[model samples]
Target: MSFEIIGKTEQIELMASGKAIHDLSRLEKQYGQGKWRKLKGVALVRLRNGKIRKAELHWYEAHGIGKKEIKRKRYLD
Candidate 1:
């Protein structure tokens, strides 16, 4: 789903890190080599439909590569 984050993510938590990430190789191949992490957070997002809602987001991140493949995992409200 396509959406824009309306504000900062809150309740940030790590779901996985380093070798725990199954897509480690793909992440590095696409973004660059670094310590990769999978995380989940809550934030308000403006979806493609132009409606705003709270959602649980999942994404991958690396030191210098930053957040990648942000996805809306579920609607929180």
Candidate 2:
């Protein structure tokens, strides 16, 4: 039961919702309150036509979610 999400705008929107969903009461009892980070990265992409392009990567990281950290990355390039 797993799937992948693609797109920068969609990923950022999801981050907003995830941030709002997390609070003191919902924080994992075993861990401290968590924080989030968005890292901008780059990658190489090959198109259908066999051309290589530089891609912009949008990666979001969050911790303390039920004892596990979640990371989501999006491509915008």
- Best by the lDDT measure: 1
Candidate with maximal TM-score? 1
lDDT of candidate 1 vs native? 0.93
The residue-level lDDT of candidate 2 at 15 comes to 31
Candidate 2: which stretches are off by over 4 Å? 1-33, 48-50, 63-77
lDDT of each: 0.93, 0.41
Any residue pairs clashing in model 1, and if so which?
Answer: none
- Residue pairs with backbone atoms closer than 3 Å in model 2 (clashes): none
Structural RMSD, model 2: 8.6
Residue 35 alpha-carbon offset, candidate 1, angstroms:
0.7
